[model samples]
Target: MLLCPYNILHKAERRKLLHAIGRCLFSSWDSPVYFSDVVLADIFTSFAQVVGDVWLSLCMLLPGHSILKPHTGVGSRWILPTVMSLPYLIRLRQCVIEYNHQGNTHRRPLYNALKYASAFPAIYLSAAQGMVVGEGGAAATWFGGSHIFRLWLLAGMVNSLYSFWWDVTNDWGLDLLRPRSEAKKSESLRSPPRRLVLPGLHSATPHILQGSSSIDVHDPEGISRSVVELSVRKRCHALGLRHSLHFPLLVYPFVIFLNLVLRLTWSMKLFSVVNVNSHAGIANFCLKMAELFRRWMWVFIRVEWEMIKKSRESHTKHRADDGIDEYELIPSATIERTPN
Candidate 1:
């Protein structure tokens, strides 16, 4: 039976393959679950759905109204992104409910707030795009240039699409919510942990040692070690924090790059054809999203750093038994002479 590729596979292997297939399919439609991945996906899908809905609404409400007309002053862009973000935020809130049940009261509420806040920028950006296009028409009426308006609309659409893709694929936060399959859990348990060493903040020597059991102690101070240090000391053998950076690379860089492009496009425009109200709204939204992104990134980095630091500290504690001082791992600038 082992020789048959389909029938011979163990139950665990079958489950793993099934999960992988599910992931591949899900990623094609929705963003892969990672920390913040869902938020990113929601931003894009929500914006697209909103824009489409608004377009349909405008077509029905004002059949004779031309989006290209100079008098409209750029209709609401906030409607689409805001509308889209709301459902996803609600869903995210539901996800957090699970955490709340686990006694993570602080984290549950905090995540809910952050998810809600994330939608604001997407809405604002959509609004800005709409306003910019509308104001360009106004500018065209006064300045006698239609080409600029066309270019602005084209660029805005391109930027919006770019933003949409960013949200669809970049979902780092979602992975945190997904439960690992039994096969994965078993494989993880079986594999040996990898180690990493990092430079000490105060010393020239490589001070961080991360590996299994190095920082697994219950002490609070030990929890402050960096992830790299802990990994080297084998403390994270059971924690599985050493996955490849594939998910982040697949999602965040694209969003960041797209936002940068949009910003650059805005900066390159010589005249302000974008409406003030719309621009302010979109800017505010982008600012909020950026702020949340930064905060999440900071927390992830800090946590990893703490894990490493704890492992190193644990190593130092062990060394103390062999006559090494706590300061030995961290070298001092001034040396004291020993008296005979």
Candidate 2:
């Protein structure tokens, strides 16, 4: 009878030991190995998609100057945005395929896809600017010296700046306005009150008491509370304002300057100054820019890897210092008696 019990216990312990070993191996494979694969895939995919989109967009925008030529000029302007959007759609499709294949709960791929997609508009805008202004055009007369174009450009600049500012404000602003599920309303409630008071002659008054019998109706918590409320509301608005201004303020001016320089260099016939050598130079410049972008992507990946490594190292050290071993996780006597 004692032998029977001992046999059963041994079998049970053996099964448990096997399970633990399987778990450890699975964890080891899942974390670092799979993580690296996902990261590499994401970095390459993002870089390729962005570059491809930019190239495609440029091709569409400057069809006469570049490879892409639409047979119809009726819907030509729409071609750039449409063609440039393909890479993003392709990336999404790939993510879905990977997700189905991997069958893992980790959403790294999906997250990466969404993040890259979110930046697509901005990327498109930047690339479009490069195509339109960086390369001189027949349409140069419209944008180069036209008052209407300048006004439109100024409007775009102001809008982008305001959008960006509004985005920043909203992002860092009112926690109370965000959805309860995503926003930590409890944390906001628990935050300590700001002691900094507004400086003014009538800081305490809501409406300054300019005349006799005027009541001061200032709520001390009003500004702070308003800030918390404004956080979520202004996020998109601020970002839009800021991003919109970038093209007008920086990109347009830079393009104009480059055009002027090129014109001066080529005796004011910038478009007529084109030659085989010039074409080659332009190609080389584009290739170099692509290379630079690729290198930047690699740098980003390296930084991510380093951060992950440090995080893992710290976690491992913490576990070691705490004397938390996998073997010790189960309180079985058989595990205790096993050799370390």
Candidate 3:
């Protein structure tokens, strides 16, 4: 496992190795396993689905076996919450550790930690509702819409909205919620980060460009200062969005809308309309599949955002040293290497 990192420099290869190491070693390595919201959330979601499938397989092996059914008994009541909340718990711990190590003057980590922590009340409260059995030995309806259910619903809404906001503004690197003037000034296309770090490690540190005026001082390759502003302005106008519009112009708004919709639909698991307590069934499986798909989309955009940020930082550094402000992203196959 240790050799995997030494020999394989690719993040994807290292991720496969880290998956075999399990959750216990998430934060142990010098380059800790990358656990973005998508990854950690997937851990809970995928694990739950796997466990459910395993139990279903067992049920298939021994027909008409009540004991083998997944999440059917009191024991499963606790198990559900543990699985659902474990990812959030891990992130919350990391946030706490970060805050303890580095003082919470800014309170970014603390606030972020609270966002993960919010999942607990909703998860546990939903599980608690299952404990109260109703007629025909089924989970009760929180005593016909009682306080606990209301509180859980409230928690779910808060968590969903907060998480969605963070996903857009923080995770996906889109300042969608900011005012139009500020958003345009800090166009995500123009301002790329100077450094890249894993999520939950640190708050976003934006390296804002020091206005179009500074471009003149840095231009050395006969590339006029107006070219920089023109490039950014043209791209910004083309994209018509305030994010890392690295993809097609319409993609930014499309993903944002889809993300918000999926987030709301995922939260439906908390509602009485969806039988979240039942781990086995078409409804449950469909919900998990939907969440899985949403997370897959999230991973794509999140990784792209990170890569673009890193690329911009590299470009910034190269420009500083080489006096080259503009560069093309050539195909990897087209690059010819010099012999050693």
Candidate 4:
């Protein structure tokens, strides 16, 4: 809701900026169906499953070799696929929850069955990919400076878990996914639920004996509909806050630091040169998985950001309407008139 200062820009340019930024900031807030919320559910989740399976296929090319490849048996062969399929598994669960409940009863079984079509492929492929990629030896064995290999591995694990939680909550509702203690701890941070009151409509017939407090009215249809919609909206607000992604207060920053430091220090050396050539297939599949996750995240983050913008805008508008001129709700494009 921060207004862009357009004093330097021409009127037309300012108008264009306002429109683009307004959209960038906020989209669907009151509506249950966010435009991009289901984008991953309908398409990308299944796509990732396919990519994972390809990796599995590549792993099959070299049988019985550990993820620690050149090292042979240091790490479990299944580690890579298990880590890789975390996102796919999370999405599959979300798909079941979101799509399975929609549409007619007869097609529900068909819809659920299709989730497996993607899920199984991704799981198998990831397992294969994990098994084939041999390790580059001990982190200290190769790079020697601080054993950064473990850092990258941990980062990957944490990021996947974080993303899984984000998808789960957004598809369902936040309150449904939140642990009870976490919910209680964060209770003071959320905005309070709005109260719904249709003022004069609720009590039209005053009871004189009850000091005009008790009353009844049953004549108007228009007022009744307003009451119903308002009730539903209020109930929604009370039910829960909107769900979206967030980094853990403490862990996210450290994860960022670790990624920057390790990637800078180890770079391509983290993966063995021989495996890079031998496991080109698995590498390609990993890229596909990364691409899939990046796209899914972009959708979730962008749309959720839009909602945040909208919510802020609504708040600012409310304040402005209440005569708080300190924060103007006026668009930047509106031209001010100067009398001659």
Name the candidate that leads on lDDT. Answer: 3
Give all TM-scores, in the order shown: 0.29, 0.28, 0.62, 0.32
Alpha-carbon deviation at 260 in model 1, angstroms: 6.2
- The predicted structure with the larger lDDT, 2 or 3, is 3
Q: On residues 1-340, what C-alpha lDDT tens digit does candidate 4 reach at each position?
A: 2355656547666665555434323433332333343453444443543543455456655666444332324354444445445545544444444444544355432444353333343343333333333343334243432334354344444444444444334332344356766664444244322222232432342221111132233335645654665466444434443323243323323433333343322212222222323445666556545544545444554465557656656764564465312222332113244334
Residue lDDT tens for model 1, 1-340 = 3234565559666665555434432443223333333334333333333343454456446756655432332344444444444544444544444344544454544444454444444444444455545555445453333544455455455544543333222222222213456434533443333232232443444333433343333444555665444355243223333333323433444544544554434322211222322335576456446544643553454344445445556755565474322233221212234334
**Rank ordering of all candidates by TM-score, starting from the highest:** 3, 4, 1, 2
- Residue pairs of candidate 3 with colliding backbone atoms: none
User: lDDT for each of the candidates?
Assistant: 0.41, 0.38, 0.57, 0.41
Ranking by lDDT: 3, 1, 4, 2
* Candidate with the larger TM-score of 2 and 3: 3
What lDDT score goes with residue 15 in model 2?
62
Count of clashes, each model:
46, 28, 0, 9
Off by over 4 Å in 4: 1-153, 163-195, 201-275, 278-290, 293-297, 313-317, 320-340
lDDT of 2 by residue, 174-219 (tens): 2323454434433333322212222233243234221122222355
Backbone clashes in model 4, listed as residue pairs: 26-306, 27-306, 53-125, 56-125, 56-128, 67-135, 68-135, 69-134, 69-135
* Model 1, runs deviating above 4 Å: 1-53, 56-92, 95-99, 102-109, 121-340
